[model samples]
Structures are given as C-alpha cells and as structure tokens.
Target: TLRPGHAQLAQTARLADLEQRLARVEQAVGATPAKLSRLGVGDHSLLATAQHLASRAALLDSAQLDAAESRLTTLLTKLDQVAEKTAAITGSSDPDRDKKINELYELAKKTEYLSQVLPQTLERMLALQELHQQGGEFAKALSEIESVQVQLMAKMRSNGETLASVEEGLKTSFATIKSNMEALDGRVKALSTKK
Candidate 1:
C-alpha cells in the first residue's frame, strides 16, 4: 500500500543499515591477525616447555633406567654369591642341623629344671645345718656357716637366673638365625632353579 516515494526511502534505509553491519565485520576481521599473533606467542612458550620436559623424560629413561637396572643386576649377583658361599660353608646338605637344634633345646630345658631344683636343695641343706647347731659350743660356727650358706645360695640363685636368661636368649637367637637361614636357602634354591 506504500506510495513509490515511501518505498524508495525504506529501501535506502535498509541498504544503509546493511552497509554499517558489513563495516563492523570488516573491522573485526582486520583485527584478527593481531589477536592470533598474541596467542601464537603464548603457544610458542608452551611448546618450548613441553619439549624441555620431553627431553628430560628421555634422559631419565636412558640414564636413570639403565642405572637402576645395573644396580638390580649387581644386587642379584651379590645374592647369588652369598648363596653359594653359604652353601659351601654349611655343606650342600645338613641332616644334623635339626637334630642339633633339638638337642640344644633339651639341654636348655634341663638347665632350667636344675636351676629351679637347686634352691630347694639349698633350703633342705640349711634345715639340716640348723638341726645340727642346737649345741651352744657349735652355735657360733653354725651361725657363720649359715651366713655363708645364705650368701652362697643367693649367689647361686642369681647366677642360675642369669644363666637361664642367657640360655633363653641364645635359644631365641639361634631359632631366628635358623629361620632366616632356611628362608635364604629356599630363595637360593628357587633362584638356582630359575637359572
């Protein structure tokens, strides 16, 4: 329903708006290269850092990995040598080892039993000494004897306790040593079999 003059005016306004939009798009496009250059600078630094890290990783793989492998090989060799030396010293087979341990254990038990029984024996001896000392003339000598006997019993008890403790310690130590040796022997056998 518009007249010819109005239609021409509307078309001119639309064309002007389109031209303004085109100019703005051209301005953004013109600025794009500068923005990309700034981004490229950041990317270059990041790429350099990544390359440095990669080189370090490669160095670690070549140097540290080889060193670790060599150390492990050396340790294994030493273990093998120790195994061989142990076998030589202990002999290829020890049938008496367990028997000896059992005998030592039995001896320790007997020693412990004797230690316990010794105090009772000393007490009985003291009782007998007291019965014999009822006469006045022998009283002083009996007193002296009793004192000496008491001191002797005390010393014996202390020595017995110490001996028992020492024996127990030796027993525990020997057992631990035996266990460790057995474990080592098993490992050596396993390693030898593997080879």
Candidate 2:
C-alpha cells in the first residue's frame, strides 16, 4: 500500500519536471527566429526540446507518465495555434540546424524514456541485492553502470545548456517587444494630445 504522501511527492516531482520541460520549450520557440537564422552552437538542442514536448504529449498518460496529459495536450495545441499565426514570418534558412534539431529531439525523448525506466529497474535490483548493498563502495560501484547510461546522462545535460541559452534569448526578445510597445503607446498618447 502506497502512502498518500508518497504519491503526492511523486506527483510534485513529476510536475516540477513537466514545468521545467515546458520552460525549455518556450525558450526554444522564442529563440527560433535567431537560432534558425544563425544556426548557433546550442540551436540544435533548443529546437529539439520544443519539438519533442509538442509531439510527445500523446504518448503519455496522466497516471503513468505523471503528466496531466490533457493539460500537456492543450499546451501543445496552443503552440500549434501560435505557429499558425506566425507561420510566414519565420523560415528555416539553415537546413542543417533544422535537421540537427530533429535529431537532438529524438535523442532527448529516448533519454527521457530511459530515465523514467532506470529508476524502476534500480528499485527492483535493490531488493534483490539488499544485504550486499550495504557498503558505500559497493553502491558506488553499482552506480557506475554501462557506457550507454553515462552517455545518455551526458547528452541530457548537453541539451540543458542549449535550453538555457534559448531561454536567455527569448527573455531578451520579450524585453525588446515590451520596449517597442511602450514606445508605440507613448507616440499614440502624444498624437491624441495634439488632436
């Protein structure tokens, strides 16, 4: 029997993860204008994260995936709507960046899937190795798994920096937009006062 608090904690962790993922997507989409134009170092992972979060909502369920699937689906739908609005403003000039972004997204999705699985596997393994799992050194040795696991974790982090860069770019864009709006509004007020 699972305690209520245990389930709540899991939900909290999962929601935090989902929110973090959403933040990454917002940052990526915000940076698309520049990233697609220049094809910078972190551009691949940035765009990939956005594409994955948009596409993967269908494969998840509320109970198992720990995402409120409906909310995610709605969020993706809103992104599609936004895309429709500005579809013509942005063009993917850098085909190589676009391709790399797709590849990165696929890799990120695979890594996320594995991360969700490995913990369950580790829990089962712990039960079997309990008595022998005592030594800190033994735990450390067990922690260092195969090369594949190491690679996945590294790749995930590699993606994080890209996401962070995207976020910064987006915030800067937002500030510019706000400043432009304020300028326009001030002009409107001046014109009205003259009238």
Candidate 3:
C-alpha cells in the first residue's frame, strides 16, 4: 500500500521528469528559429515585450527617463496583446489550467501597473537631475531608485507573498523618492532665487 506522502513525492518526481523532457524539446526546436517561424509560432507579442524592454534599457543608458516611460507605457499595450494571444492559444477549456493561466494574466496586469508607476518614479528622478548642484547626493538617490525599480521588476515575476511584499515596498519607495525630490526641488528653487 502506497502512503499518501509517498504518492505525492512520486507525482512530484513525474512532474520534474516531464518538465525536463519538455525543456529538451524546446531547446531542440528553439535552435532552429527558421523552422519555428515557418510553423507560425514566430512574431509572438511576447517577443515584442522583450524588444520594448531592450529599448527601455537604451533609453535609460541615454538618461532619457521620459522616453523610457513612454516606451514602458507602450509595452503595457503589448503585454495586453500577449496575454490575449496566449489565452487564445491555450484556450479556457480546462478549469484548472484556465485558473493557472488567469494568474499569469493577472500578473501581467500588475506588471502594467508597475510600468505606470515606474515612469512617475523616473519623472521624480528627472526632477532631481535638474538639481545638478547636488550631484553626488542626487546620483546616489537615483541609484537607489533604479535599484528599487529592478527589485520591483523581479518581484512582479514572483508568485504569492514575495510579489505582495515587493508591491508594498514599491509603494513605500515611490513615496520616499517623491518626497525627497520635492524637497530638492524646493531647495534648488530657493537657491536660484537668491542668486
């Protein structure tokens, strides 16, 4: 007689083995991009989201926060498209599978919210950049803000409690960044008036 725990362990082992086989198949097929293209799985909107992220990196490198924000905004649209396309591909025929996919879709929406908040945060950074007289302090603050953005992005991909904690962290970080930027803006303005 198999114990319940033993049965659960066996199920887990089977799942792991199946995942390994699926990965190998994907690797073999992925190596031949042209074949996949011909088979009509190419041009996925998910790739478009990746392309937007690449462009966002370039924008950030150039210190174009506003442009980066715009790019992220557009990426949100692409994310929506990808979610819908994915749902169409893996239709809601099975209740259990549909529930799992719905979670992914919800995550995408949350990512869009993060993207929206990111620009607002970056705008605050841009305002701080205008106060270049405090270069060192401003740069350090900017670095921290960017670090938060990275953390939030990573958290958005996580499941359950980690994701919830990161979202709350982002809210706090944004509030702090905004408050600091406002203070700096006021200080810069006062100094300019004195000059």
Candidate 1 runs further than 4 Å off? 1-137
**Which pairs of residues collide in model 2?**
none
Cα lDDT of model 3 by residue, 42-151, tens digit: 64433443465677668677558877788999999999999899889877568988788899999998788788799899998889887765888878999999999999
Angstrom error of the Cα, residue 33, model 2: value is: 99
Superpose all Cα atoms of candidate 3 onto the true structure and report the RMSD in Å to 1 decimal.
Answer: 47.4
Ranking of candidates on lDDT, top first: 1, 3, 2
Question: All candidates' TM-scores?
Answer: 0.29, 0.26, 0.20
lDDT of 3 at 165: 89
Alpha-carbon deviation at 181 in model 1, angstroms: 1.3
lDDT of each: 0.81, 0.77, 0.79
Q: Which one wins by TM-score: 1 or 3?
A: 1
What is model 1's C-alpha RMSD? 45.4
The stretch of ten residues in a row with the least summed lDDT in candidate 2 is 35-44
